[model samples]
Target: MASPPPHALIIPYPAQGHVIPLMELAHAMVDRGFIVTFVNSEFNHARVVAAMSPSSSPGNNGVGGLDRIRLVAVPDGMEPGEDRNNLVRLTILMTEFMAPAVEELIHRSGEEDGEEKITCMVTDYNVGTWAVDVARRTGIRSAAVWPASAAVMATLLSFNKLIEDDIIDAEHGSAMGKETFKLSPEMPEMQSAHLAWNCVGDHDQQATLFKYLVKGVLAVDQCEFFICNSFHAAEPGAFSLFPKLLPIGPLLTGERGGDKAVGHLWQPEDAECISWLDAQPEPGSVVYVAFGSFTMFDRRQFQELALGLELCGRPFLWVVRPDIGYGKVHDYPDGFLDRVVGESGGTGRGKLVSWAPQQRVLAHPSVGCFVSHCGWNSTMEGVRNGVPFLAWPYFADQFVNQVYISDVWKVGLKAVKDEEAGVITKEHIADRVEVLMGDAGIRERVEELKKAAHESIQDGGSSHGNFDKFVEAMKQA
Candidate 1:
């Protein structure tokens, strides 16, 4: 008799950045003949369903295409009318509230008719530890997916060592007045301020994040294998620090080939931006700016970014999510948008939207540069498309990603932030955009990295080999 097809339960942290990649992984698994159950928070699950609902776009039919892939949701313990953006609340939900529901779901998977037995589980490194514990209890195989770059993961993994060396006080969330450190001799230099969890919020918040990191390290250590959403070619030094890590990514896009059903939390609105991009002067002539799903800006910073984009005198596409600018919906500074369009002598060269089809936008030939927040997903997209960056990192792993892009990869230039004022002014934004746009060497390097990214996922490539090995490991388990 033939064996049952492998069944895997996949979960991500309840964030857009985390959900997208895990969805891509599920797609790949389905292609490899695994039955997949993709889990999301109740709120985000609705958003994703809405985003993929019929009457949206081509090839988007609310998960109708992939018969083997199933999406499931569990309550995140968020009360009605509560602010879902609260980090403390989210952490509590992941560690405490969501555990029972997930475990119960696992139990039900076994009883569902026509489904294979739950043989394996895969989850995001930061958010899926609770699921890992459940998998262990049920005698199922499990792996932790590190959803960030290998470099970022390596830095987080070194937190314990940094504490022992007095480089950082993990208990008190203090960094011993030191501004810089390296994870290893071969690793790129990192700013203490750039540590993803360092000084993220108030003292209590910082301490909470610190404890989360400590717990994450321990949870990851317990996993059967650590799967990273990065390619070994990108960060060799960082990969060396974690020998057990399986680097099988640059999973920026999926094999489904532009299918909108691959779980976008936010639907792509205002797609006219694409036609506007096509009408630009030439290939690699327009600047593209997006600060990812979360980064918030104050009024001054918002004004600065708008005015600065106008001052650059370039054809540009900018995504300004509605919730940005402290969620107040601040008006643009008195015809700033008009001035940007009017400056190019009546052709309306600049376009702004609430959200963009990012992968498609970056892949556009007219897009020359990316002004980004350096969220790992955005970072990977920029690299995948060979678009050099004007880095404007706000918080979290963004600052570290900016270091890798600007200082290490040499394909991006950091936007000067007035750290004292807690903003990057108009002057700094304009200056950095001009500097980054003018660099032929950076553009060339970006093209090389883009080629490398594509190559890594091709047949016999490093990522391909690693992914094959990972699948075999899961089968053996």
Candidate 2:
């Protein structure tokens, strides 16, 4: 038999945003004739399969075309029914739990009677370190896939320097929440406030997470290659900072042409959000709001945001996960939802749901603006769809992403914060929303950015060409 095309193993951290991009990359590899095996945590496998069954119609037919792509679930060191408190703890578990499982999988996959001898492995940057010893033991090549913008990666690479300069530290009195510090000069016009807040905590747990992040990057440097889910033209200055990083994305572009064939790692409920948008009078007339899969706001912040949206007097689709904050069903300001619906004249102008189809919503003609947490995936999706943003970044490099969205691209506007408390007020939210959606000059600038984002991913475009080159490299390797 002709030697089975080089077998490759693809592993992604289990969260929603992380899983989706890795799935896209795996699909790309499969299309290029690689024998791919996608590994997931045992807990996540159950969730994904449950989400994929036909009964789960809204889900992307979980594992539909995955026949060629073997699915493997390894233990993540958590006992069944572990709490999974929050993003921070879960991330640490991902690193600590993944190493042995990956090593075991490699050995099993390379057996003489196995489906194929593993030749290469690709994993997310967060989990890349776990694959290092495994790849070395199995004599297979490995690459790190950074699912964020190059700017974020550049900031991460400079963490050691930030620590050394005494700008941030693990000491009890370290300069964390202070406004005086600034990001390294090496970073592109970024401020200290934009750094991932987790990196600044004084506690050991937080400090350890930063240490682990640094170690992960160093381990990635030892890998054969590095990949980022970004287009060259979108952040040329940032891309140039990393000599080994490859910008190969806008991966959601193909799906933009109204193709429903693209797989959704998280199957969303098909609510009437789209139908509501369809009834709107003009294209690009609605505001789309979602704070990704893991963000949460305090009750006061949530109430203010609700008031702001109502004050804007615009049609909107909002996703509010049940467990968004403090692990309880969020209670919006009393009578707030009723008032917004009343103001819209009951044409279903505001569709609030636990979750909605995000990519589809962004691509819809009625979505003129996006209010987002500035997570990298959501940011790319908004840019690709040509929708401007109202940035309300939560933790992580989301703050830096806001700088890119507002200061660099000038397509989006930031919410004004209280000068003393730094909390964004509802009035500030309302004012910025009006400026982005109503001002002629602001609209024109946003449209121009839309054009640039589109050009960056077209054929012969920076992202497209890089994708082609990436496949060629994988094949040659």
Candidate 3:
């Protein structure tokens, strides 16, 4: 008799950044003959279903031309009208609520909608390890997926080490006034104050995040594998410093060989931007600026960013997501849109979209530089396309990712915020864009990383081998 096909239930923390990459991982699993049940928050499930190509069905939500994958959602312990953008509310609810919801789903798995017995589980660390414990109770194998760069996870896993080394205060997790330090000699140098949890929010929020980290570290020993969406070739030092982390990523869902487009939380609303990009004659002349979904700006900073793109002069494709603070409907400074991005998101030197097909945008030949928030997904996309960056880090791991891109990788330059104004002004934005696009060396270095990224995902590369080993080991369990 043949064995039952492995059914893996995959869940990500409830965020667009988290969902997209994990969806890519599920796609890969289906290719490897696993029956993947991808889980999302009720809100995210609707958004992802709406964004999928060929139109996703509520009854069957497989995406990207894969038949073995299914999409499911569980309540995130929130009211239907509650604001999920509130991090504190989200953290409290998910911590107190998500485990039970997921447990219920597992308990009912064999009873409905052609569902098979869940043989394994994969979940993000931010969603808490309670789900992992539940998997163990159900006698299913489990793994934790770190959605950030391996180095970011290194910083998280090194909290006690930081205390032991006297780099941060044990009580508050604040930096002990040291200017800079390294986790190990091999790891990249990081500012003591820029510890992963420190830069997230205020002291209370930081403490909440810190609590999660401590719990995750303690519970990680039970999981069979702790993998990350990072490439070993990109962060050898981080990998060496934390050998437990296996790198199996740079998962570009926009595969080179014409795979169907992947689902996005926000649908790509502007096709003209790509046409605008193609019209640029130079090999790499267009500036592509996009901050991922969670970045918010006050009215002043929002105006500054708009005017900065206007001042940058070079042709640019900017994805201005509708909810970048100041409400869903925001107005730029007077005459700003008229002067740069004219009617139909074109006719002028710049074009703006509510959302973009990011991987496709980065892969365009005319796109020379990425003005980014340094979200790990953005970081991976930029590296995969060999686009040098003008880093505008907002918060959290973004600052550390900036250090890696500008200081360690030498393929980008960080935008300097005005000490008095506390934002990167239009003049500074123009200056950085010019410098980043003109640097031949930065361009060359990123091309090297881009090559490594593609190689790592191909047959026999480090990521390929690591993934193969993981899948084989999971099959046994």
Candidate 4:
């Protein structure tokens, strides 16, 4: 009889953004005949299962090649009703507690028979090296997966080096009296004050997160392979700087084979938004706006946004999470919803859903420009589809991504906020949308990038070759 397929354990940091890409990676692995143990925190596992289509069972089985992926849940070391949004707390709980839980899992998995014994572990890089330690203690191979842009990982990896050079504050990794700077001349420039960790919380919180970031740097020394969800053509400077970062992604579901990706972490309102997109005008007519899972805004900012969309006088699709304002209710400007939704169905003005199947929405023909919070997956999707962007960076590595989208790629424009109100005004939004949609040069540039993204994933192309190499390495394990 033929040998059974290799078993691989995959774990992601417990956040919607982090889980989704790794789930894509899991799908990619299953496509290659690897049976996977897909791990989620107890909290997220429930959320993921709940969000899945009704026919999908909670664990152990899936459709298509996904049948090989077994869903497993471990506690996040967080209690029910605790704040999962606290980055520093999550990091501490994950590193200190999750390591032991995963170690126990590895041991039990090895006790299995035949090829069902796990050959390897692939974990989110942001989880620090604790997951790596689990693999080490259990005597199997492990690979660190960076779900964000290669540029962001480069920044994280370079934090200590920047500290040693005194280019940034050693204690905090912030800029030394500068607004923005690049790690190297050829790379994109980023705000020093907006260092990824600095965007999360106050001084104490920033310091705590930075400490874990330092541990993440140490993770590089302990981990085996460092895989990134980016393509070489997408960020040549980042690949050139960090040769160790294997570029096997921009891993869209359309590019992969198998069941739909396993991580939604929320119910996807795909039917409504997609049907709405179909009814819209021709290519490049509708504006697509989403701030991703975590970007939140206050009442004033929300009203300003609604008013801005109305003022654009263009068709739009907006995804608004229920808890977007963190349990606080928001009231739109007078007649805002009536204007958009009432006329939207008839004239293709506006459609709002709590959550959307983002990849499918971006792939739609009518999506002309993206008004985004600059999350890497959304950034990659927009780039892949050749859509222009109005970059609205909220925090963390998103600021750096905005730089790449606007300054480096030249395919998007940044939505500059008012200094006085500290919010992007309605007029600013409407005007930027008009400029972005009307810019011939921006459209042409994004078209070229879209072609690059396409070519890289084809046979013997850069990404294809890299994925083949990674698969081969796993086979060796």
Question: Best TM-score goes to which candidate?
Answer: 3
lDDT of 3 by residue, 315-386 (tens): 888787765354243468887777787865588888878888788899999999999999999999999999
The ten-residue window of minimal lDDT in model 4 covers 253-262
Using lDDT as the measure, the top candidate is 3
Candidate 2 matches the true fold with a TM-score of 0.88
Question: For each candidate, C-alpha RMSD in Å?
Answer: 2.7, 3.7, 2.0, 2.3
- Tens-digit lDDT track of model 2 for 158-186: 66666676656634222454544434344
Please list all clashing residue pairs in model 1, or write none if there are none: none
Clashes per candidate, residues 3 or more apart or on different chains = 0, 0, 0, 0
- Residue 390 CA displacement from its true place in model 1, Å: 0.4
Per-residue lDDT of 204 in model 3: 82
Candidate 4 has a TM-score of 0.94
Alpha carbon lDDT of residue 212, candidate 1?
Answer: 77
Stretches of candidate 2 off by over 4 Å are 53-68, 110-114, 163-166, 170-187, 197-202, 253-267, 324-330, 342-347, 419-423
Instruction: Provide the TM-score for each candidate, comma-separated.
Output: 0.93, 0.88, 0.95, 0.94
Residue pairs that clash (backbone atoms under 3 angstroms), model 4? none
Q: What is the C-alpha lDDT of each candidate?
A: 0.79, 0.72, 0.82, 0.81
Worst ten in a row by lDDT for model 3: 253-262
lDDT of 4 at 73: 80
Instruction: Please give, for residues 163-210, the per-residue lDDT of candidate 1 as tens digits.
Output: 877778868556786778888987998887667777377667777877
